[model samples]
Target: MNENKFIQLLKKGDEKAFETLYNEYASKIYGLLRSYLKEDEIEDALQDVYVRIYRGIKGFKQRSKLSTWIYKITVNTAKNYLKKQKKNYLSLDFNLEKNKFTSKENVEKDVFDEIDYEFILNSIEKLPPLDKTIIKLRDIEGLSYYEISKIIDKPVGTVKSRLHYSRKKLQKIIEEDQNEGNG
Candidate 1:
């Protein structure tokens, strides 16, 4: 089942076609979910992403590849979930455990300490949403310019510029921190 046929099936309300599409991309979606939901299991997040995709597929337009559209939905949902978690975390009384935490021999390191793919992912999350999206879609996921342009609904030139800017910004952040540490 190719993208065009899958999209047509989605438009026509075919459950089997939807299942086929979900199965094909579930691993990619699950990887994104597992990264965002570090507290959760891969299978659990996979189920949630599929539920969201099923609910969301009807509103999808065909201008972008079905994969890109699905990825956008997955990322947006993850952001929303994170926001809610942050809000809940903030409401907790951290002061009660401040002394307890400080007394422990904490071993957490700076996320930017590494100079590899995981460090890159950590740094990318620190960037603005549009920039993060541009870098991830174009550089990490390796979507073609045409595909990213369609998914972002931006001109190809704009996508190219944003990607370049995002990479430069990340490089500057990492380099500046390293220089500061060594100095």
Candidate 2:
């Protein structure tokens, strides 16, 4: 079915369609929420995001893709959650965990990769919220600049520039970390 039709069904409170929508976007929304909320808060935030989507679906104007609209809601819901909780720290739960290794060499490589991934995730956490969000949306979520622009209510050029600067800053942070480890 077309997205529009599915959305229409969602608007009309069609249970099956809403279930489909939830199944489709749940993991993506959860990952996005993990970046903004603490682990303990994630399940609640995910529920809140879907609740907002369900209630707001009728008012959605279709100016953006449904996914973009959903993402915007998720971001706003997370901000609200943070505000309510009065928390200062943000976490990017980019769970790039590796589980299976074949040989000693592969095991060593996996360990190094896990360390590198952890270092990068830590570096990203140090970024300002906007930059962190842009990085998550583009690099982690694989969203286009336009979609990010819509979700964050910024210009496409701004999204592009921020993503560029964020990547460079992350690289510098990683390099500095490596130098310090070596030193």
Candidate 3:
């Protein structure tokens, strides 16, 4: 069945619809939560999202598409989880400028000096929240600008511009690593 049919079943509280929805979006939801939450917190947050969907499905009003609403819920839920952790733990708004690596200055043990996909992901981890989300949604998740606009509740033009800027920022970070290597 199509998304609308599944949503109709979900609205009616059909258990089968829940299973179908879970089977379809489980990996996407898990990937999203994994990007933003700890491993232990993932399942809890995922459960919370579904609970919110169940209770709020009636009042959804269709202002946005179902998946967009789900994506927004996922992002909000993850943010709430992080906020609770911020009280006694690390500050999430970490500074990337302080962590820039210089290969020439720190070459004592060259075993771990190689730059690769995981290295790039580490650099992405240091970006601001919006930039990180924008890059992930556009590049990693492969969502289109229109869908991303709905998911983020931003104007389509704004989504396009931010996506462009996000990719540029990532590219610049990559270039920094290259220049550091060349130096």
Best by lDDT: 2
- Cα-based TM-score, every candidate: 0.56, 0.80, 0.71
**lDDT of each residue in 69-170, candidate 2, tens digit only:** 999999999989999999966777664333321112232334335455566677777787788888777766667889999998899999877877766676
How far off is model 2, as Cα RMSD? Answer: 6.1
Q: Which residue pairs clash in candidate 1?
A: none
Residue lDDT tens for model 3, 1-183 = 776776788889999888877876777777676667777788899999888888988777776667778888888888789888773121122222222222221221142245465666666766666777666666556677777887667898998777666656765777687788789
Off by over 4 Å in 2: 95-119, 181-183
- Model 1's lDDT to the true fold? 0.61
Q: State which candidate has the highest TM-score.
A: 2
Q: Which 10-residue window in model 3 sums to the lowest lDDT?
A: 88-97
User: Which lDDT tens digits does candidate 1 get at residues 58-163?
Assistant: 7877777788777767666665677766732111111111111110111211332336544455556667666766655665556777777766668999987787
* Cα-based lDDT at residue 44, candidate 1: 55
lDDT of each: 0.61, 0.79, 0.68
